[model samples]
Target chain A: MKAAVIGIGLIGGSMALALKEKGLIEKAIGVDNNVTHTTKALELGLVDDINSLEQAVQESDLVILAVPVHAISGLLPRVLDLVDRQVVMDVGSTKAAMLEVIASHPKRSRFVASHPMWGTEYSGPEAAVKDAFAGRATVICNREESDKDAVTLVEDLYTTLGMHLVYMDAAAHDVHVAYVSHISHITSFALANTVLEKEREEDAIFELASAGFASTVRLAKSNPETWASIFMENRENVLDVLNEHISQLRKFKACLEKENIEYLAELMANANKIKRILK
Target chain B: MKAAVIGIGLIGGSMALALKEKGLIEKAIGVDNNVTHTTKALELGLVDDINSLEQAVQESDLVILAVPVHAISGLLPRVLDLVDRQVVMDVGSTKAAMLEVIASHPKRSRFVASHPMWGTEYSGPEAAVKDAFAGRATVICNREESDKDAVTLVEDLYTTLGMHLVYMDAAAHDVHVAYVSHISHITSFALANTVLEKEREEDAIFELASAGFASTVRLAKSNPETWASIFMENRENVLDVLNEHISQLRKFKACLEKENIEYLAELMANANKIKRILK
Candidate 1:
């Protein structure tokens, strides 16, 4: 099948690579607004060729949107307006904004809202990895709203790519991501700022950093443009999680200030419960 | 050289395994106050045998303290009192508090205060892994206070174990670690708590958790006993960093609350500068 992957950055590029690797995508055309990204995606062999969005959408059997939430929301209606029978899915982080924007589109069933629940700190075509979404959850929101044929085709392709599909409403999907994915980026970025502001000497962070610190702060290196668009699109949910996170930090701070070892141990044990869910 | 590894837990046991793997320690005798850890240490081949603290200290050419900070600080002086020519090193997280505890010991020159800048969330002898310390920093604090021969022994052994040795004063080491290491644990635990409280359903966390969330909150699963001891031992430094960290979080929250995309992007861009230090 021919596929058109929009954005052609990390997620889109990776999707192309993974599909082509499995021979599912006989011809994958890249569609990116950034000339550099389009050139890099082709140079990295992330796609078979580059094409205009109009040309790619008209010709491909599948159109995958992997741009930032704002861009996806802006382009979804236009893409849906052009597609005849092709299935369109987005791998953006936030779902509610884009899903709501295209809720009343005339050809809504041809569009599927999907988040692959996978990413890395780096971005652009250079950051794409083969089999990036394998063994990770891919949430398909508002599946009941889409046509059965379109949903089945998307699910089958994801299954072939080694993903476990979890179906949820767009609202629920946004809330879950805000709790898990979006908040992590904020915490990591904030943590990186905390260390950078206090630890003036760069050599010290380089010399003293361990596996724990690196893992915790790794997300801080994410592309600001992409994340800023996400935080803006999903402002309320992200704010809600950030409020809870700040309160949690305050609780830890108070325990440390009072030297309440018992309370501190209890708090850490409570946090350890995350292992039950994470591992 | 023969080495007696005290505590026989994660850090100590891993040290024993690395030393044995490199043939740096011909005989590794494990000394642990906890019976289960001692048994596990021997069963896992983390050490050649188990022994009492007195016998181990007396028999070995080197005594490596790999216990919680509280235990290390409490036991350092007594161990030093018993040592004749054995080079003693404590691989505890905090340096200043423990260094001050045994500052005036007649045998202070025989003791080297070291903190291996590496660990996993899990603990106990079962958590020990071969080559755990390789490619990580091993900070030797107040090295000038330790005898030349003792300091050289540790530096050489750590070098052989594939570790880079960084030298600093005890106070400086404590402060730096509070920023780079201790605060990360607090942030991760707080983040875990935030998610646990908000996402009541365990399945949602599992279904939606991306690599970003898992990596950022991984430290939350750390052993409470080990972390509580470090926070208490480095109370002042930890409190200092915690205050700065909370302030940074508050800044992020205010920016998000205001829906100030420009400000949030700028903050994340600033944080991205951490790539310079971390990589």
Candidate 2:
């Protein structure tokens, strides 16, 4: 298969690498608006060649939209208009907005909405890594909207790459991602800001950061263009989760103020159930 | 040298394992209020034998108090009363309260207040693992209050375990830990509660939890008894950071509500500074 990956940053670049590594694609071509990313993706051997979106859609059997959430909403319909038998998919973090934008498109049947639930704090072509999508869950939104052949092609490709595929509606996917994914980024960013605001001593933060702190704050280092788009696209659900999160923190603070050890302990023990669920 | 680890749970059991693994102690003994812990520690080979607090103080050359913050605040001075040239230390999370509790004790010179900036979500004797302290920082608070001999012995032990030792005042230590450590736990626990409350679909969460969510929420799985005490003891500092964190989230929410892409992008870009510090 000849695959064309658009916006070849971290997710797209990594997906390109994974496809080539598994010999699933005969040739993987890269497409990006940024000249630096285009050059880096080529230099890093993430793609066999750099191609324009027009040319890539004409020649490739598979075309992937792996750009920021807002970019995906704007670009997917344009790509869908041009592709005939070529299978189109997006690896965006937010699905409902993007799906709604393309729902009325003529070639919507060729487009599959997918979110491979895996990412790191880094970005750009240079941040692309091999074996990036293994053993992670990928959520497929609005599967009923895509043609069976297109959906099966995307599913088989992800399965071949060792990802667990699950199905959900675009609206439900947005709500769940807000809870499981979007809020995490918000908390991490706020955490980094909190520490940076309060602790002026840089050396102390560097010296005292344990693995727990590092892991919890890792998403704080995510790309601004990407996350800001995600936060805006899923604004209502994000706000809902954010309000609940703040309320929970306030409860915790009140418990601590009252020295209510028993209640605080119960809260932590309840949260500890996440380990079993996560594992 | 002989080492006695009081309250042989996660921190104490891990310390005992490190001491034995590094061949720094000839024999390591366990002391805990719970008989089950003592038995489990022995069964797990974290200690050579179980000993009483008095027996541990009488026989061991180095005694480490690895109990909760509340217990450490009350127990440190009493343990110091029995000090007969034996260097004693603690691995509590809060330093200000513990240091204040033993500030005027005559045997303060024999006690060292150290907090190893390392831990996992798991707890109890079963959580003990070899090399837990490697490549982590250990902060020694109120160093001036400790005798020269006691400081030297405690520093040497941490150094032998491949840890970097940092010196800071008790108040400063509490503030930094609140910013770097305690607040992370609070955010994580609150995040878990937020998701649990908002997203009622348990199976969806189980299916959609990505590596990013797992990393950000890992601290939520921490032991209740241990964290409740730390939060209560460090309530003021924790509350201060928590308030700042809530304010930060509110700012992000408002920016999203207004679709202020510029401000949202700038906020995320500023948070990206954590990459430079964390890496």
Candidate 3:
């Protein structure tokens, strides 16, 4: 099968690599608005050639939309309008908005909404890595709305690449991602800002940073364009989670201020249950 | 040299292993209030034998305190009172509180206040592992207050174990740690709680959790007893950082709610500076 990956940045570039690695695609063509990304993707051997979106849709059997969330909502319907028997999928972070945009499209059956839960605090074509989606969960939304062939082809491709596929409604997917993934980025960014704001002397922070702090604040380094779009698209759910997170922190502070060790211990023990889910 | 590790749990057990690995101590002894820990430390070969605090003080040339912050403050001076010429040091998280507790002691010169910038979420003797302190920073606080011989011996031991020794004032050490280390745990614990509270169905969280969430929330699995004490001991600094952290989150939330894309983008871009510090 021939595949065309749009956006050709971290997610798209990495997906292109995975598809080629699994030998599922005979040729993977890249599509990006940024000339630098397209050139870098080709130079890095992430794709066989760079193709325009119009040409890519015309020639490829499968087309992937792996751009930022806002772009995906606008671009999916246009791609779906042009493709006949081709299976088109998006690897976006937010799903509900995009699903809404293409809900009534004539060729919506050819479009599959997928979110492979794998990424790093880096972006662009240079950030693409091999085997990026292996052993990670990929959420497929509105599967029943898509044509069986499109769903099967996308699922088989992801399965071939060693990803665990799960199904959820687009609305539900947005809520879950807000809880499990989106809130982390917000917390990390805030944590970084908190430290940077308080510790004005950069040398002290650099010298004394521990592994725990590094791990916890790692996501603060994620690309801004991608995250800004994600935060905006999933604004309501993200805001709800953010409010709860701040409330939890306030409770923790209040308990500490009162020197209520027993309550603090109980709260921590409850939080410790996260270990079971994480493992 | 003979060494005794008081409170033989995570930090002490790991320290004993490091000392044994470097051949810096001929025989290492363990002292803990819990009998299970004592037996487990001996069984795991973290120490050669289990010894009482009095026996350890009488026989060992160096004594290391690896207990919680409050315990260190209460126990260090008592241990110093019995020491003749032996060196005493601690690997606690907070420095100012512990330093202040032992400030006016006649034996203060014999004690070295140190904090190793390494830890895992797990605790107890079972959590100890070899090479724990290697390739990590060890902060020695108020070193000028320590006797020359005691400082030399403690610094030499950490150096021999392949750690970088950094000197800082006790107050500054406490403030930096609160920003870099303690706040990470607070954010992680609150994050875990936020997810658990918002996502009533555990199955969604279990299925959708990505590597990002796992890494960001990993520290939430830490032992409560250990963390509660640290938070309480460093209460003022922790609260200060927590206030700033909550304010940052509120700003992010307001930006998202108002769809203020420009501000959100700039905030994330600023947070992205953490990459340089971490790298």
Candidate 4:
């Protein structure tokens, strides 16, 4: 199978490499708006060739949208217009907005909505890595909307890359990701801001930052444009989770202010329950 | 040098292994109020033997108070009373309260207030691992209060373990950790609670949890008792930072509520500045 990966950045470049390496695709074509990304993707051998979006879609058997949520929303319908029977898929963070935009499209059955639950803080073609999706869960949203062949092909592709698939509605995917992924990015971004603001007055604080602080704040280094697009795309759900997170933080503040040691201990003990799920 | 490590838990047990592996200590003495911990510490070879506090302090040439901050506050003066010329140091999260407790003791010069900025979410003797402190920063606080030899011994010990040392004032160390360490744990705990609370209603939310969620919430698995003690001991500093963190989070919330994508992107861009410090 031949595949065209749009955007040709981290996720796109990585998918192109993985598909070709695993023999899932005979040739991988890159379609990106960024000239530098296209050049780098080819130099890095992530793709066999670079093509215009319409040309790539017309020539390839598969079209994978791997751009920020907002860009995916704008590009999916246009790509669908240019597709024949090609299996189209997206590897975006939020699903609802993109899926909603294409819900009434004639070639909707050719597009599969997926979010492989994997990424690093880095971005762009330079950040693409092999085996990026291995051992991670990938969510396939509204599978019934996609053609059986298209869905199966996308599922098989993810499975080939060592990703376990979870099926859900696009709306549900957005909500769950709001709780699990979007809010985490917000917390980390806010934490980085908190520490940075503090560090301006007290320069020595960052020296004491250990693995704990680094792990919790590393997401702060993620691309701002990508995340802001995600937050806006999944606005209501992100807001809901952010509000809950703020309330949760307020409880900790209350515990400290009132010196409620027992309650504070109880809160932390309750949090320890995450061990059951995380491990 | 003979070394006694009290509290035989994560920090103490790991310290014992690193010191022994580095040849900084010929024999490691274990001292803990928890009989199970002492037994496990000895079984794991984290120490040569389990001994009473008096025996451990009296027999060893160096003493490490690796218990939680609450226990250290209570044990420091008692440990000092038992010591003659042995260099005593602590590996607790907070330093101000611990140091203040022993500020007027006749044997004050024999004690060093130090916090090794390294730990895992797991705890106890069994969780201890070798080379845990290597390549991390270790802060020695209020070094001028300690005897020159005592300070030198602690510095040499951390250096031998392949850790770089940062000298800090005890009060400053407490405040700094509030920003770098304590606030991260609080954010993680609260995030865990937020998700757990949401999961109670939405069962499938956790299925979509990814590495970003795991990294940000991992510290929620930390021991409740240990963290509670640290929070209460450094309540004022933690509260201050927590307040700042909450306000910072509010900025993200406001951006989402107001649909201010530009400001949202700006906030995350500012957060990316952490890359400069963290890397």
DockQ of 4: 0.80
Cα misplacement distance, residue A63 of candidate 3 (Å): 0.8
Q: Supply the TM-score of chain A against the true chain A for every candidate structure.
A: 0.98, 0.98, 0.98, 0.98
Model 2: chain B TM-score vs. truth?
Answer: 0.98
User: Residues B94-199, candidate 2, lDDT per residue (tens digit)?
Assistant: 9898887877889889998999988999999999888798899999988888899999988988999889999999899999999899999999998888887777
In order, candidate lDDTs are 0.91, 0.90, 0.91, 0.91
lDDT of 4 by residue, A41-142 (tens): 999999989999889999999999998889988898899999888999999998887887888999999999999999999999999998898998899999
**Chain A TM-score of candidate 4 vs. true chain A:** 0.98
Question: Considering summed lDDT, which 10 consecutive residues are worst modelled in model 2 chain B?
Answer: B192-201
The TM-scores, one per candidate, come to: 0.97, 0.98, 0.99, 0.97
Cα deviation of B218, candidate 3, in Å: 0.5
* Model 4 pairs whose backbones collide: none
Give the candidate number with the greatest lDDT: 3
lDDT string for model 3 (B76-154, tens) is: 8889888998999999999898888888999999999898888998899999998788888899999999999999999
Candidate 4 chain B has its poorest 10 consecutive residues by lDDT at B199-208
Model 1 chain B is weakest, by summed lDDT over 10 consecutive residues, at B252-261
Cα distance off (Å), candidate 1, residue A41: 2.1
Q: List the residue pairs that clash in candidate 3.
A: none
Q: Clashes in each model (backbone N, CA, C under 3 Å)?
A: 0, 0, 0, 0
Report, to 2 decimal places, the DockQ of model 2: 0.84
Find the candidate with the highest TM-score and give its number: 3
> In model 4, what lDDT does residue B113 have?
89
Restricted to chain B, the TM-score per model reads 0.98, 0.98, 0.98, 0.97
